[model samples]
Target: MHITSGSALYHYTRSGTSVKKLYEASWVRYCAVNRSGDKIFVTNSMSELLTLSKDGTILSIFTDRQLQSPTAVHVTETGHVLVCWKNTIIQVDIEGNKNVTSLAIPNVDNPLSMCNLGKCIIVGSSNILVLKIE
Candidate 1:
């Protein structure tokens, strides 16, 4: 599934309809699916992270001002949710949706993208930085 420009999550299929609308939320910028692909996570511009069931049901919502411009999110094997803002990385509890901790990256500017690389997080914007979460 991918986020449309109108902030809608869409899953394209080869059936007659071609595309299926999964969920609609405001300002959605990034999305991540767990390794099992059962739970999907999406982050928006309003400093909110939304967890959705595979069938498009809202499971939980996490909001915080510190989640400013949450550019990316990933779920770890150990049931941890990782989110990246402009210059900070936040670790959250997957089940409780609670903020566990936050780490700041020095000299990071407008972080617009992120990805998981096994043991590290790849944050990219003006440059690429690899961060190991311990």
Candidate 2:
């Protein structure tokens, strides 16, 4: 998968065939595909989270007021969508749909990116933060 800033998201097969393309006018900062390969979560410069299908269809969009300057996104192995913005990380529980929680990471300043590694999550900014999942 590839994302072009202020443009679109492209998905290519292993053989280099372009399978899907999602066009967006906003500046796309980051994206994460779920473990099942059926859902794609995207973060834009406008602090919005866009949920799309594997075929690039818009499924849902989260534009909560608290999502300020979302810089990174990741999908956990258990299917939760993690969005990093400002000094906080918001976990969108996909199973419950309504269980959204925010976690404040100590000493994390202006987090720029994040990814899941086994049971832990690594967030990067000027410094790095590793959080173990319980």
Candidate 3:
């Protein structure tokens, strides 16, 4: 689902010939579609994260005090939401209430992209850095 800044929600159907209207919003960005295609995760960019159903209903919104400029989001196999911004990555639980962890890449100059490769996650900016998880 794609939410336009002008307050329109657009979604493409499986048939690829049909389009559906989800809802309206003043601002929306950074959308992550779930594997099941029944739900979508959206980040307001300037604000918090929003979970919306396929039919246009808001399932939940996380308003944690520590969230700042959430620019990138990815969901893990364990159903955890990983948010990346600047030099930090925050992990949020399924309910969006519990914060699992917040990781900061030490001495990162300018991180522009990131990729997860199984046990290691690579972040790229002016230079590429890989972080290994145990």
Candidate lDDT values, in order: 0.75, 0.78, 0.67
Count residue pairs with overlapping backbones in model 2.
Answer: 0
Backbone clashes in model 2, listed as residue pairs: none
Worst 10 residues of 1 by lDDT: 11-20
* Model with the higher lDDT, candidate 1 or 2: 2
What is the per-residue lDDT of model 2 for residues 1-134, given as tens digits with 9 covering 90 to 100?
65545567788777878776775755776788888888888876667788888787878888777688787888888888988777888888673143288898888877888887898999999999999997
CA lDDT of 6 in candidate 2?
Answer: 51
Ordered list by lDDT, greatest first:
2, 1, 3
Residue 31 C-alpha lDDT in model 1 = 76
lDDT (Cα, 0-100) at 78 in candidate 1: 66
Best by TM-score: 2
Clashing pairs in 3: none
| lDDT at 106, model 3 | 77
Specify the poorest-scoring 10-residue window by lDDT in model 3.
Answer: 1-10
Q: Assess candidate 2 and give its TM-score to the true structure.
A: 0.87
Tens digits of per-residue lDDT, candidate 3, 1-134, equal 35444345577655554477675556664566566766666767456777778776888887666677666666655466776677877777765556789898776643545557777777776668888875
Candidate 1 stretches with Cα past 4 Å from truth are 13-19, 77-79
